[model samples]
Target: MKLTASAKLVYNFTGPTEVIGLIQASHSGDQTILSEELILSPDAALVEDEDVRGDRRFRTCLSTETSIVYTATVDNGMRSLLPRSGRQHLWNELPPEALAYLLPSRFCPSDSFQRFAQREFGSAGDGVSRVMSILEWIAAEVDYVAGVSTPESSAAHTFTVRAGVCRDFTHLGITFCRALSIPARAVSAYSLDVQPPDFHAVMEVYLENAWWLVDPTRLAPIEGIIRIAHGRDAADTAFLTTDKACTVVSQTVQVSRVDTAS
Candidate 1:
């Protein structure tokens, strides 16, 4: 499916501030890009780099207040297929690139949840079934409350509170998957047709030699999701990161589907 997406962030600076942002769509095997427009007011020198884990990063130093506007139009053909039963990847057969996701991370402490995961999902039929069970449990147990979780909130906190936004749900899912020895990572994306449209967060679990997308919030269709960044947790995939002091004056994100048959 084809979609158009944009994000605008207005910042007020008391002094010079350096910023690093990861808000551009990732050019992956499944998504085809048609066009993209990015602008920084009072333009400064911008540098782009890809991290070791394949996350794209953009950096700029701002001496004056500015607005960051990013717009993109792309076709997303990556749709979630029906979960395959009895499909699982053993530890010895897994690829080296997927090893990091199986370990604990900043927001997702998979090591601490081993007992809980095994007790709750150990009897599941297969890896995919356990992941489905985890998704269902989170969807039913967690309350989707906005502004309740802070940037420092971790999977353990969300698990205890049993309430959080999409990011929390994703972290919990990733944590559970990793605790059970399944590789999982957090995914940032522009989700078309999601209510209260905004930049959305979901997750992907590696199973049967492929990463499969899963939305714990179940708020958006899998086909309408366009990935921007992939990371172990929210810390690595944040839309904006800064080394200097700055206050957010205003922020807005918009996403919509465009009909081509007009």
Candidate 2:
């Protein structure tokens, strides 16, 4: 299977922003079932991107303008990849000293999440299964609703509200994985082939010494996917940035997966 997607971002700011940054998390990577063949992030002065090993990585671009425009595209090759042992070779660099500090306060580094790990997956179990189980549980238990929250939304909110979009879902997944010492991070990217290029979010966990991506916000639980940008959290990766003094007039996005039959 091959997957591709595109996103056009438009920004509006009243006055020049002292500084503005945009995160285009619109690239998918090679997976057990998918391989990224090509990824193109628009270099239109306002968008600079980099290649990463995981599902979503950021191309941070800074601007001092009132408005900015940019686009991103990703091509993925689908393959059926799965978990294997001895994969955590790269993660050997992960320091225990950094584990506790990796997650911030909003991530809910609480005993509730920690204890849940003990009761459900046990703290010592494999990281992939632990993260996967948490994602499945979140997707099944939480209902979906639009305009309910933003990327700054908390994991505790998702568990309580039982409804939110991709940002909320990924937040819950990230917090849970990190709380359990799995070294999960939040990914903010675009979902192409989606009716209005919607912001897609996911959580990538450190396992087998490397990062394995998971999309808790999979609009559809099927395969054939494209990914974009990723970061520690939404704060580190947002598709749009407004100037300090500008007012947004309107915004829209259109994303679609190519239907070869069409």
In TM-score terms, candidate 2 sits at 0.70
- Per-residue alpha-carbon lDDT of candidate 2 for residues 1-262, written as tens digits (9 for 90 to 100): 3344333344443333443444333434452222222222322233344545333333333332223333433344552332643222223468553353246555444335777655765543456666667767887888778877765677777788889887788777777766666677765544544433565666666776556667786673234444445566766656554434444544554444546685
- TM-score of model 1 vs. true structure: 0.96
- Which ranges of candidate 1 are over 4 A from the true structure? 51-54
lDDT, candidates in the order shown: 0.88, 0.54
The segments of candidate 2 whose C-alpha lies over 4 angstroms from its true place after superposition are: 1-4, 19-69, 79-102, 105-112, 123-125, 192-196, 220-225, 242-245, 258-262
TM for every model, in the order presented, reads 0.96, 0.70
| Candidate 1 weakest ten by summed lDDT | 77-86
What RMSD, rounded to one decimal, does every model reach? 1.4, 5.7
Clashes of each: 0, 26
The all-Cα superposition gives candidate 1 an RMSD in Å to the true structure of 1.4
Question: lDDT per residue, candidate 1, 1-262, as tens digits?
Answer: 8889999988977777788989888887778779998898878789998766455779988877799999999898656563766466888889998999999999999999999999998688788999998988998899999888998999999999999999999999999999999999999999977777778999999987788888899998888888899989999889999887788888888888868896
